[model samples]
Target: MNCEKIKESVSIRTVLESFNLLPAKENRKTAFYFALDREEKIPSLSVDFVKNKAFDFGTGKSYDVISIVQQINKCSVSDALKYLHKFDLSVLEKESVAEIDYSKNYEIIQVGNVRHPALVQYLKSRKVFEQRHLVKELVYRFNGRKFFGIGFLNDSGGYEIRNKYTKICLGQKDVTWIKNGCNTNNEVIIFEGFFDYLTYRMIEKEENSIPDHLILNSTAMLFKVKDKLKVYHKISLFFDNDHNGRDTKKMIQDDHDNVEDCSLLYIDFKDLNEWFCNFIEKL
Candidate 1:
């Protein structure tokens, strides 16, 4: 079979399971299985059922069904496909929409209100302490070690975890949607990160007029939220003044009407949060 046929025939979960690499944990949407070769106290491999792909966040290695078979079995292309041919994959065509979870390799040791002194200080240093209600203090363990960070919940049930030293996502990396009591879909605003959204909450003088918000968290996720974007009568973008952000702005403009690229307000700055912080410095 061709690559496309092969891809359609094999599932990511199947490849991992076929190797007898059982998941250490599983959330509703994702299976936290161990890597192909490496043994660990915690599983570092994340399997996305919705996307049919796997990522070893610990090693920064991504895998597909075929690649996974090759990795686990150490076999050639023909051999891998032959092994994958045992099961009829026709059922996957009508697969259920599973939840996307990212807690595969990490265990939450503690999750509390955003009250950790260091995390609070981190927010203050970024000029977003006032918007602390929008985040959490998440303490999780990975590889037998504990780590904590400021965490924001996205629409995908995963956390956009961040701190001074760590920026990795803690679950299925996805967008965060906020409908702040706007009855009609009159207007909508988009942000690349929660920091920008929180910064806007901190800086925007007009409170009641604030439209709904969508935080992509990562630019690669922009495609997933496009359908949601079409519902708004007016769409405003607050992306960074960088290549990925700028490119995404153009892409959105091509598909949506009444769209505004508001990044020009801080054209010289990197992002909305940067502009807010720098403006505060000047004041």
Candidate 2:
């Protein structure tokens, strides 16, 4: 299919879902997703179902169905068209008008210390059981069903909820910044997720002093704090070893003079947690 024909036929929602990128917020007319090009705390990629297009408020960039695929996959126009050709017209029609309920409405049933055996085992599996105090046990009800998980609170009063089978945000998605109780510290270490932050804590438990920590929770949030990060003298990034992680690390390096990419410590693994687990196995 030609680019024009594909753009006219496919819905932007279908393309996003095809990549497993769900909207963080949606209503009848429009939905918001994390920017396709970056990690973010809030969903700024405004998708208009009727227009069959998306706009990234973060970057002031607009995308058609074709361009959306190209931007997301980092592919050429021809490649994007080939990827879109796989979508049947019937599927496109169905997706164009389909109502996607992205509401994560839930009530907190309880929030307390991490004590459940399953949750404890989960922490142990990650080799962060001693760091369990840093997280909470969350019980919440969603769609009339009860569920529980280990919850790490963020700066925005939201929980980065995780379990053996699930990983989700239970409130506003935001970064988690942890100060080391010293006002003069100019160095801060950035992590891609909470577990990586916890892994660092586990590895450095004996250290009398440590730099401040910032957990992006999602790389899209990097933009929200890029200006704030300049206050630090030294920035250490412990992001994943994948494409997005590399991109984010490079972005920080480009913007700051004292930034360091510490992913080399876990160069063979996908992330620090994976490397820590393997290290534990060896011992």
Top of the candidates by TM-score: 2
Give the per-residue lDDT of model 1 (tens digit) for 73-143. 78898887777654325432222113323457778888789876557657976999988888989998755
Q: State in Å the error of residue 162, model 2.
A: 0.2
Model 1 lDDT, full chain set: 0.78
Each candidate: RMSD to true structure? 15.3, 18.1
* Span of ten consecutive residues with least summed lDDT in model 2: 94-103
Runs in model 1 deviating more than 4 A are 1-103, 207-209
Model 2 TM-score (2 dp): 0.63
lDDT of 2 by residue, 38-138 (tens): 87898899999898888989999999988988887889998888787655474433422314221256788999998776677579879999999899999
With candidate 1 superimposed using the best TM-score fit, by how many Å does residue 115's alpha carbon deviate from the native?
2.1
RMSD of 2: 18.1
